[model samples]
Target chain A: MAAKQNQENLPVVLVYRRPQFNLPHRNRLSRHFILLDPADSQEPTSSFLSTYAQSVRALLCVGYSTITSETLSLLPSLELIVACSAGVDHIDLQECHRRGIAITNASVAFAEDVADLAVGLLIDVLRKISGADRFVRGGLWPVMGDYPLGSKLGGKRVGIVGFGSIGSEVAKRLVAFGCSIAYNSRRRKPSVPFPYHANVRGLAADSDILILCCALTEETHHMINEGVMTSLGKEGVIINVGRGSLIDEKELVQFLVQGKIGGAGLDVFENEPDVPKELFSLDNVVLSPHRAVFTPESLEALIDLTSANLKAFFSNKPLKSLVEIEL
Target chain B: MAAKQNQENLPVVLVYRRPQFNLPHRNRLSRHFILLDPADSQEPTSSFLSTYAQSVRALLCVGYSTITSETLSLLPSLELIVACSAGVDHIDLQECHRRGIAITNASVAFAEDVADLAVGLLIDVLRKISGADRFVRGGLWPVMGDYPLGSKLGGKRVGIVGFGSIGSEVAKRLVAFGCSIAYNSRRRKPSVPFPYHANVRGLAADSDILILCCALTEETHHMINEGVMTSLGKEGVIINVGRGSLIDEKELVQFLVQGKIGGAGLDVFENEPDVPKELFSLDNVVLSPHRAVFTPESLEALIDLTSANLKAFFSNKPLKSLVEIEL
Candidate 1:
């Protein structure tokens, strides 16, 4: 570990408020490396970054932390900056590139985990397994109610928006369920197995299942608007495992209320941890607190992969998944 | 269709309540088969027995409705009786055999469906998908406490009892999730992919996930008693899709409360439709109202297969699954 760290001094840095990762490990990082934590100062131990900035390079950070052009001017050794999480809106990527410092991100790492969760959420919601548990637990068994029987995954049409790594992985699992796949990307990839549509409304019109797998890019923000919901057939089910900002929560609630779509499985919301209160009375939606990447297997894979990337970076090797920042 | 039924005059009358013969075209069979709408009648339709009884070589049935000796005596032409469901306790197999009758059952038909539900139930239970949905529907989100994070199915050790068709199917799916499989049957089948044990205690001792997939017979009743529970390790999970009689519900509840076993996913209950209210408060367990084989795909398969059997029977061919009642 020591030999790898000393091989080359990693100058640029970015960090996020993630559940894992600890301080003793952070302290062991090279003092010459720029450090940034996206989480607001919720933990007293996170304040160690201010004192360590003297020998730092450049910062692409989040939350209460800031990286001004003045701070950029102070660090003569500063070269590049990157955000650790998917959203770069939190980081001043433009300013970093304006100062000739490259910017990057850790977006693709979560693709598979999020995609897996999307499929799982879709299955759970459609099957009504959770409601059955609630019914049994409530001691309301044999009460003779209209329990919903579920449909098979086989022979269903699934539409995915944003044909990125996560979208592709989700496509793979759905294939195993016997579903016919389709997707819509900013620009169509001719190599994809499923039919790629030109627009979100086209995908919605064709799909029985609509999946939001796109990132929270500006043009993509709130892309799941009222029009798209109307296009998705009345029996269609939507699953969102992407950025909360990508969906129009109000529109979703309205659609759910009117039964515009059969059901929805959401891991993210417009304002998460503060989901729209109006969404609570609808029996057609399944909700998760934006947690698709937290599975133990995925977590272990994520840490090991990220650790490998860091180790490689410190060893003067080309970094993996280098996010391109426009200068 | 009428002419075909007359030509195929089934020698042994196998009565499966809600046989789903019309699932493919539910609306189509409104006039053909002697449909026994359990909702409309507490007793088997008189026309059902009378139409097929005169030439009825045997009586094949299930436990949904009472089948008394008098009912059996009514069919003087009865020579054999087979049950389509797994359990024979509901049928007076003794009286049938005493009357020199034979029997058979589609014992393994529901295995695949049950196994599918078992996995679904476990995932839903552990992930608290239903609870999240309820929270979202009840307008409690966006002002919420904690969003439930689900566990992954991969890397768990699955223990199966009665290593039969359903148990084997469960093992197959669990293996896909990267789980190590172990099972106990009356005797192990060497060709199976999983490791087999001689007793339930051995299976429980090593498994992280213990499942009940055995038939409900005298020898297997209450097999998952206190000793079996103790052997299943403290962190183990149990899923029962076999029979209610196999588990002691009171003991299971106690063990769950005491944290002896991690959780349970139950489809059948000792006294179903009357599940304990205490079960609902705990977040660990998932419950289904014995509706595992109620999926559209399975329902279609059941109807198609049963219709095929009926067709074959009237054609003077032997039945597909013949159980030896006289043996």
Candidate 2:
């Protein structure tokens, strides 16, 4: 009954300040509901949120932006936290659950493009596509003789770290290329035909390539550490299209430097927009600017999904792409 | 009868002088026949062959090295020419046919890797994998904002320019990626499941991507010219894994500059080792030195196939990968 009264008074959406690279979400969002962005005010974010504490029913979180318990406590009337990215690690999930506030994310939104990127990075690292391009672009092809031979994609034992929507899409594409598929997920999917290893180490030990496509949580943070990379071995490669924190970046860099791991195709980094300078010079490592989610077609899809999720939440309809907070 | 006598005595295999980058074929070839390499001799190539012309019945023509009528005339005793590469454009086929010299090539050996490269390039160009990799490595992500979005590959209309072994392999791999396959072959392949376009322009008109995998012949020379590129429209991508002569390079460059065509993934350039300076700066294009056939595993496969073909010819058995000269 109190919730009904809150809806009667025009529902308010509190939005975080836009990241440097974010696409404009306000103009489209303003067409539906009243948006209360903190950046619009000259006052500090905490101060602005505190002023509208009783009215803000939902918060729209941007990529990699934090929502700590202290911040959550400031918005006592908050009900839903809408994340604009697939990885919700930046959000305090425990606090959301404890407060009984529901959380939603861009899961179905970025799945296809991220999967496409995961496959692209894997193929690039395996075939030396980017390295060869640099060779030709540098005028080295004409003067420096032939580029070295690259490994084949067919017959490779590819182990996916997360067997979710994106990982499955990646497996589907690689399967067409004749790669043997295996995986390590939080829980074994009985219907999935690919071999499942219970742990990342076991998956790495059995895999020729380890692809990270899982979400980041307490159990999965730094899951691909030295021991996992060691199990992956000298001939094995790592492809990360998932969140950067999923792998221990320091260990991966050290292993890449020592040639303990064969190669890597990384889209995300531990401190994104700030990759290690050491990786810049490596021929085998293919670096992407955290853009697995930035394809134009993907961006269009995201805008539609974002709008739908927002509208559904405001009208109190069933939410779109509502992520299970625990899983 | 004479062939039997020549086989009884160790058969003479004449090898052409290799360019700087070719692998050493002597140690491996020595097991089956007496190798008569021109580079081993201090005398002129003509003079060296003249001394053992009668004994040198088999000629192993190294990659794209011309076997002109003049060279063939000098080796009057030569009856078989084993080409070490797939395309026999450099070899004067009319003269070889007039002389009744049988030929075998590395088509079967390099088909899979070449097909693998074609798919890799297609994915690279469409997804901007290499371009995005360059953006990250340049440290542009921290300040330069989001990289541009790329197109998806799953639903693109891919037209193969040939339907031979390599072409068919490319089709199989692409079909797995959910691409709609079509073809433009000299004759309709009744057995092929893909739709057939009678000419290059028609194929381009219907295709979102064009994959050049045909042999470069008199009929196919400069096949993908201005007309074809124009027909392909501004959104089409071209992947050339075949010889560079298949496309008119100037027209391609002009089209790319004007955005008449979307992008290209070129492994073979018209004047290799001399790619257009303009191409070096284009983010959309993915350039590779003519290396689709040179993977270490493919090289090992080629060595085996070469050995088998040589042994088969000497033993008077049917040849493997023997080209249908007229077809």
Candidate 3:
């Protein structure tokens, strides 16, 4: 829905964090005297509502920090709730509907950076690059080392679990590696140029490498389980740039120990920051802490798009990624 | 010169080190009561013999070993000298030429393995996979550490020096990365599809990365000097898979230290087993002990092909890669 147009000195409170306004186009959100650090009391810092709830006609916050119905009730004047992050999982949609507030997000800027990470992890696994480096630096070369043997990625089968924007971008990068691409999603994306598999297990079975790039929803939660791991061939590798909840952590650990699958490269885990010790034991795995979309370019794009998204909301234009208001 | 068609049994001395032969065709030399380790303490090894003065009609030897003409003068029966390596640089070629002896070398089998190493080094440098692993494993991650950043080679400009068989194979593998290829050689080889540069420095300046794939010779000695390194841009990366003598070690070190050139990947060093200590200080350089052609596949091929070359020599057929004799 288009934002309501009431442009006569409408007081709007900028939410949690603001982008650095040092560039050429910095005054996009200047008219809305932003509450830079909104909630400094209950959360101690980095929350928006605790400080400016009374005067907040509009609440601009990120998706991670909580935005409760109680917090919205305090902002009785809040008309727009714009989330800076892509996902709206943390927002209370039911409350937003009751309060008659509009919600929008920044998402498109994330896909490119996330997809680059996915492809980089894939190459890291196939080439045994991480393992070799450890071998070399540990003074293992010509000492405690075996041959640095590995197969090239010029002719391998790659299976992508999601056919969304990010997954398709991953496929495009893998295409340059001369690998065949196969993907599985909820339904076949008709416009997709590559082959689609109806089942993730089958995709894993046919593929030399399996990449997880799907969204984290109830249907995909713990989808890569024991069966999926077993179905993957002996030399199969797994790369997950998607949510950690998509994988069954216990089953992954067991598979890694038995070498049921060749290796894995993970940017996320079942829990944020609470990784198992066994995962680090195996030299075959490469791990990152859910920061795939953390490039400088991606961050700037996200802030610009999110600011534009908020500006569009206040100006009564159709929002880019609108969701139900959690009033 | 052809092998004698009807020769009586004679004492044949194998005076040097070579890979063990398991070929049935080597029996051609066996008819003359061939010796595996000749007890000629006073005689020269295979490399230092005259064409007609040595008692041994044929010699089999590895690279980096010596053969002398003084020993050849004591025998008065030498006819041929064969190398079990691709390079026959240590052999006394002109002395043998003066006496009409034939020399053959094994070259083709070693090309593929070296080419594989060149490509492996290329990927290792561009991806920065090694450095990433080091950062993660050093307890630098979970709380605080720098990210492992790298650039993709999807559209980089690659310049190859000494575009021979190995160089061309590297080009084939790099094509999958969507890289544009430029090359420098003694003369333009029309068979290759890539563009040729008349000047080496011009090629270095134009390329995003430079690769050395040429043989070691006087005309090409120290070709990659301070001037060539300066020609490369600050972000340019260089990979050397050819002979170490082709590059100036001190210049490369200085360029890398000053960041005049971005990085270097060296499979061969100017001196074997002794890498410069300064190179170890820089994270940008990757050093390997001249074993680009040390894979199992290439090792087997080298041995099998050398045996074949030896067999062909005793069977009165033209030998492949006859260095000291006319082809």
Ranking by TM-score: 2, 1, 3
Put down candidate 3 lDDT per residue, A1-327, tens digits, no spaces. 133344335456555543322222235555443434443335644244455456666677753566778767767777887776655556776778877878776556666666766766765565555565455544556564343555556558999998776788778766754579999998899899888999999998898899998866667889999998888957788999888888998888888889888989887777665566787667778776555654444555766776677667667788776753322
CA deviation > 4 Å runs, candidate 1: A1-51, A54-89, A92-116, A163-165, A186-195, A296-298, A324-327, B1-54, B58-63, B66-70, B79-89, B92-113, B134-145, B162-165, B168-172, B318-327
Tens digits of per-residue lDDT for model 1 on A8-56?
5455454534334332235444354445553435544234444444455
The two-chain DockQ for each candidate, comma-separated, is: 0.44, 0.61, 0.16
iRMSD per prediction, in order: 2.8, 1.6, 4.6
- Cα RMSD of all models vs. native, in order, equals 5.2, 4.2, 7.9
lDDT-superior candidate, 2 or 3: 2
How many residue pairs clash per model? 27, 1, 14
The C-alpha stretches of model 2 lying farther than 4 A from their native spots are A1-62, A74-79, A303-320, B1-12, B17-30, B55-57
> Quality of candidate 2's docking, in CAPRI categories?
medium
Please provide, for model 1 over B1-327, each residue's C-alpha lDDT reduced to its tens digit, 9 standing for 90 to 100: 997686454233334444422234433233334432332445565655665556556443543445668777767777655454655656776677777765555555556656667767666655566666666655666566556566666667788887766777777666644568888888879888778889888888888778888877767889999998999867778888888889878899999988888888888888766777667776677777776655666655554545545545557688666654433
Tens digits of per-residue lDDT, candidate 2, B124-166, equal 8988989988998898888787788788777789999988988
lDDT of 3 at B22: 30
Model 2 per-residue lDDT tens digits across residues A36-113: 877667888788778865667787887768889989989888889888888888888999998888888886777877
Q: What is the lDDT of residue A51 in candidate 2?
A: 83
